[model samples]
Structures are given as structure tokens and as C-alpha cells.
Target chain A: MQDLLFYFFAVLTLIFGFLVVVNPFTRSPVTSAMFLVLSIISMSGLFVMLHAFFLAAIQILVYSGAVIVLFLFVIMLMDLKEEARSTFQGIRLTFSLLLAGLFATVLIGVVLTSGLGAEPVVLTLEGSTAVLGERLFNAYIIPFEILSVLLLVGMVGVVLLSKKNLN
Target chain B: MVGLEHYLVVSILLFSIGALGVMLRRNLLVIYMGLEMMLNAANLALVAFSRFNDNINGQILVFFIITVAAAEVAVGLALIVALYRRRRTTDVRELTDLKL
Candidate 1:
């Protein structure tokens, strides 16, 4: 039941994540952004299976919803050259791929050796929103307030930076 | 057979794919998306570990991470837009005028 759902979403996550990186058809960022949508949505699914329902909704709302739309808007805003959009053309391609491979090997090896997947412990708590909110508003209240301020600062900074010169 | 390690494997692969995109892709937008992918990979691992460990803190951390990421993208895209306005190109290679 849950195992099958896990595999399904896991496979989808990897496939779309790969496509976001190295899609063979077109090098357009728009296509990559679409694939990113698939990847994020599946990731939220994994979160749900893990019983982090609140975070799962946030993942969908904040990530797949707001973040991806922002990416798409920027893609449409940018004027890209079709001929210049192609990636991995010459020697750098091979070198980059090699490095990427080496990185994957090292991390995957560590994760495999750790045997984390061997122990399938059943969870006692569902990690529901109310529980999360209790902890958040109690112990994590200060940081939560600070985060709001940070978001506000970021909004102001972006507007000022992107605005055309007034003087 | 799915377990914590299985989820970790998927997360790690996701991170690797993102790293490749960042290294190989020329388009700035793709690079940005790759960075986001890497962030997401981290988020996935956090949630998985939190789940298996029977904790909620990891999810809260992921919450902060996503918030920060949204702010980051806003600023980063704004910078990219400003740069594009001045140079009219999104290729990183051509934007190396500061290179001495």
C-alpha cells in the first residue's frame, strides 16, 4: 500500500528531476521549469507518506505553487536566444558529467552503507499541523516572528533592486 | 523494501541531478532551477529523517528553508532582470566583463 505509493512517487521524482537537468529535446528553461513542477509535486507526496501533512501542503503551496510560477514568469520575462540555449557542447560537458558522477557515487555510497533503509520503524505520531503549531508557537515562536521580518526585508530589497533608476 | 535509506537515496540522486544542472547548464534560469532542485533534495531528506525519527523539528526547519528560498528567488530573479536590462543577455559566459 504505502510501499507502492512510495515507489511510484519516488520514480516520478527522479525522472522529472533528471528531465529538469538534462532534457534532450529542448534546452529551453520553460521546459525545465515544467519538469521542476513534476518533481516538487511528487516530493510533497513523499512528505505525505512520511505523515508530515502540514509540510506537505506547504510544499505544494509554497514550492509547486508560488515558487514555480515565479520561475515561469521570469522565464517568459527573459529574452533567450534559441541557438545560445544549448548546454554541454564541448570539453566542459565531459568534465562536468564526470564531476557529477563522482559526487553521486560518493554520497550514494555513504547512504547505502548507512543501512538507514533496513530499519522500517513505525511512527507513533502523525506530525499533524496542530502538534506542529503547538511546538512552533511555543518553543519556536521567536524564529517564526523573525522569519516574517526577513520576508518583508526581502520584498523591499527585490523591489528596490529591480526598479529602474529614478535619478 | 522501502525505508528511510530508500528515501535518502532518492534525495541524494535529486541533489546530484541538480548539481549537474548547475555545472553543465548555461542558461541562468536553468541554473536557478537546479539550485532550487538541490534545496528540494535537502528538504526531502529532512522530512524523511524527521518521519523515521519521530520528530517534527525537521519539518519546521524545512518550513524556514522554503521561506528563505522564496525570498532568495525574488532577489535573485530581480538581479537577473536588472542585469539583463543592462546587457541584454542571460548567458553567464558573456556576463564575465568583471573578469580581469
Candidate 2:
């Protein structure tokens, strides 16, 4: 049951994802952006199936709900063109496809060969959350703090980039 | 068998698609969206791994990742806007002024 739904949504998400990447040629960023939002929502459903309930909610709320809206807004504001003369043309396209294929094959091979024969060490739902919280607030505290700094830097950079330089 | 490995394979395919998008697209915004796709692909892998390993750490890391990704998109779009304002184009071809 769960597996069936997972496959269904995964296929849906993949289709929309394909649409998004090919969207530049469609001459409508708005349509691409809408498909992207739908894809994100479908991914959130996958998260729920994984039993990461909190993460699922956050995925929908943050990604599908907020970030996508921002993307749509940006798409609306920008004056998109046909983009016929791009710097990254034929050879680059072929090379990228090749590189992506190589890396994906290698990673997939490694994962498959590893043989996940050992039964998973299941942690209780409540206990798992508690441990996660502890690690975030304690062991990974520095990265947490650094993430905040990163946000600050991004904020400052955006402001500086947007603001008119009074020369 | 449609188990954890199946999910991982699907996730890998998605990541590859994103990689292709980033590699081929000349538009910075499209590249950024490709980057987002890669991130989401990894997030799916993380959650799937967490479920298989019966750990929640992956999910928590995913939480932090999402936060950072949101911030990234925010700033990236802003930079695109600023770049557009100065150059009137978002094509990477026209960005040669700074490269030279």
C-alpha cells in the first residue's frame, strides 16, 4: 500500500521535474514554476511515507508553501527571453550529460554492492526525535550557529547587490 | 524488489536530472532551480536512508538543509535581479564582462 503510493508519487514528481528542466524552452517560466511547486508537494508526500512526519510538514510548509512562492514572484518580475545564444552550448551540454551519467552510475553501483542485508536498528519514534533534538542542539551546535551566520552573510550580500550604489 | 534500494535509485535519477539542468542551462535562475532539484534529491535520499537505518539524524540534517536552501534561493534570486538591473540580461553569455 505505502509502497504503491510511493512509486506513484515518485513517478509524478519525476515527470514534473522533467517538465521544469525543459521549461526554459517553453517560453513561460510561470508554467515551469507551477510544475516545480507541484513536484515539491509530491515530494512532501513521499517524506510522509518515510515516517518523518515533522520533516514532511516542513517540506510542504517551507518548500511548496514559501520558497516556491518566492520563485514564482521572481519569475514574474524577470523579463525572460528566448535564450538562443547561451554560453553553455553543445559540447558543454554533452559533457555535462556524460559527467552526470558517470557519477550517478558509480554511486548507484556502490549503493547496490553494499548489500543492505543487516536489519535496521530501529529506534522508537519518541526516542528517535529526542536523540535528534539532542544532537542538533548539542553536538551539531557549531554548524547550527554557522548556518545562522551564513544566513546573515547571504542577507547582507543580497541587500548590497540590490541597493543602488550612491556614487 | 521495491525496497530501500529502489528509492535510492529513483533519488539518484532525480539528482542526475538536476545535474544535467545545471550543466546545460545558460540562465542563472534555471541553474539555481537545478541546484534546488539536486538538494531536494539529496533530501529524499536522506529521509529514505533514515527510514532504512531507523535513525532520525538524517531527517534533522534535512531540516537544517532545507533552512539553508531557503536562504540560498532568497539570496540567489536577489543577485539575479541585481544582475539583470545592471545588464538587462540573465544569459550567462552576457556575463563575460566580469570574466574578462
Model 1, runs deviating above 4 Å: A83-86
As for candidate 1, its clashing pairs are A117-B5
TM-score for every candidate vs. truth? 0.95, 0.85
For each prediction in turn, the share of the native Cα contacts (below 8 Å between chains A and B) that it retains comes to 0.86, 0.57
What is the per-residue lDDT of model 2 for residues B6-33, given as tens digits with 9 covering 90 to 100? 7788789889888888887777777777
The candidates' interface RMSDs, in order, read 1.3, 2.8
lDDT of 1 by residue, B27-67 (tens): 78888999999999999999888888888899889889999
Residues A11-67 of candidate 2 have per-residue lDDT tens digits of 988888877777645645667678778888888888777777778778889988888
Score chain A of model 2 by TM-score against the reference chain A.
0.74
- Best-performing candidate as measured by DockQ: 1
Pairs that collide in candidate 2 are none
- Report the C-alpha displacement of residue B74, candidate 1, in angstroms: 0.7
